[model samples]
Target: MKTYRYLDLITALFVVVLIVSNVASTKVVLLGPFTFDGGTILFPLAYIFGDVLTEVYGYKRSRRVIWTGFFLLMLAALTFGLVNLLPTPADPQSQGTAQAFSTILGLVPRIVLGSLVAYWVGEFVNSFILAKLKIATQGRWLWVRTIGSTLVGQGLDTGIFLLIAFYGVWDNSLLWTVFVSNYVFKVGVEVLFTPVTYAVVGFLKRREGEDYYDRDTDFNPFALGR
Candidate 1:
């Protein structure tokens, strides 16, 4: 397998973002009128990372990183659940600590399902759209591909995740509100950070000498080709 100096770094960062975002999602936050989970603050960075990967390294590499994140996230979830289930010794401090641990690390089945499924679909969609756009535009406009892909990808992600995680649990109106707010906030993050994304993508392209255009590449998400 070929190695790039920064691919490993980016992949590691990508997984950290994914795992941390999911963990932070347990806490809901309200800033004035907008209601969102803590994940919203950092989840958008994952999409930016997606854009950077697909833009600089192409979809094949990006797909690999996405799968890496998915599996690591599942492992983290399983580990958290396992730890949450382990019997803790009966003591004043221990009991309090165990309860706090479960409160923070516990993973509900529906939420787990929503998170994994939505992430797999959303990230592939983002990478696939960006790859196709790169070819369609002859690589002229970076912003179009990044923002356009995020528009589609984040829209699907926000809607699918919220609906699956809270459809019946939350009021219909409230679910919709959360979905709309999260979607806007995520896409807004992509837009607001476009300058940074451009800088990173440009730097990587120059430094690594790889501006991949997936004209001949396979688009299958499951294929483990290099």
Candidate 2:
């Protein structure tokens, strides 16, 4: 393994925030009569960072970050489960708080699984496509690669997450609507942030003295030993 850099730590922290915010965002509420999960606001940032990691550091480093996120998510879910399983105080107020905590934390397993699977799938796809496009285009047309990869990657992430998390629970039509709408919203966020993404990628590459091309990378998601 290579020596750790300070920015890598920052990247890891952002990944954790992304996972936590994603799990917490499942609660739907009305925003001007349009119902949406709070997760929508934070989830796109994960993809943006995903793009940054892959673009600046390469697939191997990005894979490490992804796996770091995976373990952190698992630890969080396990901690939540353990906390929820412990006995609560007898006071009615305490009991209510415990119940609320349990209700939120109890969804950890499913949500964690959905997030892990979607993230692994979507991120790898995004990185792989972008890496290949970078080589094919000789690193020209950054916007096309970023937007194109997000279109496919976010689509897969949205579809997989919705199907796994709410398959039989939601009617097919409603499920499809949710999936499509979330996909559009996520991709829209990516599109809107393209300029920021460009700036960040450029700054990171210059500061880190690395604009990696994964020409020799092993694209396997499970090959974390790289």
Worst window of 10 by summed lDDT in candidate 1: 28-37
Model 2: number of clashes? 0
Clashes of each: 0, 0
Candidate 2's C-alpha runs over 4 A off are: 1-6, 30-35
Tens digit of lDDT per residue, candidate 2, span 1-226?
Answer: 4443556665766676676667666686544433456787678888888788877778888887877777787777788878888898899999999998877766646666777788778888988888888888887888888899899999998888777777888799888777767787889889999999999888877777888888888988889886
Extract clashing residue pairs from model 1: none
**Number of the predicted model whose TM-score against the real structure is largest:** 1
Error of 1 at 9 (Å): 0.7
After superposition, candidate 1 runs with Cα above 4 Å error: none
Taken over the whole model, the C-alpha lDDT of each candidate is 0.91, 0.79
